[model samples]
Target: MSTALKSIRSIAPLLDRVLVQRIKAETKTAGGIFLPESAVKELNEAKVLAVGPGGFNKDGQRMEPSVKPGDKVLVPQYGGSPIKVGEEEYSLFRDHELLAKINE
Candidate 1:
């Protein structure tokens, strides 16, 4: 594992929390044109780095998290607590906060 990945793995999320790193926005256009950084839009996509064991239900039953590590998830444009490990940026979000899981 890389030093950055190792550093990120050091974090163990607890209880319905998920650790994720945002997928960087594309700087180049499909037409072979390069766009300025200011013109690039931030994407809501992210990769799951780590996941909590899951939260408890109303009846005290453990509800497993919907997503697992390595899953590509779609997050909201806002929300989530930002975290930093080494030179990489990560975010912590409740399982419910995740919008959708990207199959591709």
Candidate 2:
């Protein structure tokens, strides 16, 4: 397996938690001009790497997660725990904290 994949799999997200990798900003504009790293905007978009088995409800029932691995999703500008493994960066957010899922 790829190092990144292996790194992500090393840690399983706890109940309702989702592992995500932020999608990078475009380095080039629509006009095709190359932009420096500083000129690029940071997007809040991310792709789900892994999801927890679901958290327990007040009645102690298991609540299934809304998202699954490989789903492109929207994340909040704040919150979520940051993690780094083998030189790669990742974030962990709760299922409710995830803003939305990207259809594309």
Candidate 3:
């Protein structure tokens, strides 16, 4: 984790909420050509930074989170509240808001 992320420890996620940072879009092409800012598309991929313990069920049982910190996950194109910390950008999403986890 980067230094900027270290500060995120102070902002803990409550219930099933999760903190994530979106993966940056590639600015270069396979042929080594550089793409302008407007040419790059924002990816819907993000890295899980922090996760809440679990949400309580109807019976009061804790429900485990489907994803954890350090996991790369797919997020929806819309939704999620944008958060800006220093020069980095982050988002808050419910555990169920995540689409899927990426392996490798």
Checking candidate 1 for backbone clashes, the offending pairs are: none
Instruction: Write candidate 2's Cα lDDT for 14-98 as tens digits.
Output: 9999999999998999998999989987799999999999999999999999999999999999988988777788899999999
lDDT of each: 0.90, 0.90, 0.88
Q: Better model by lDDT, 1 or 3? A: 1
On TM-score, the stronger of 1 and 3 is 1
Off by over 4 Å in 3: 1-6
Query: Scored by Cα lDDT, where does model 1 land?
Result: 0.90
Per-residue lDDT tens digits of candidate 1, residues 1-104?
12445567788999999999999987899997999989888889999999999999999998999999999999999999888666778899999999999997
- Model 1 scores a TM of 0.88
What is the clash count for each candidate, in the order shown? 0, 0, 0
Error of 3 at 81 (Å): 2.0
Q: Return model 2's CA RMSD, one decimal.
A: 3.5
Give the lDDT of residue 67 in candidate 1: 99
TM-score of each: 0.88, 0.88, 0.87
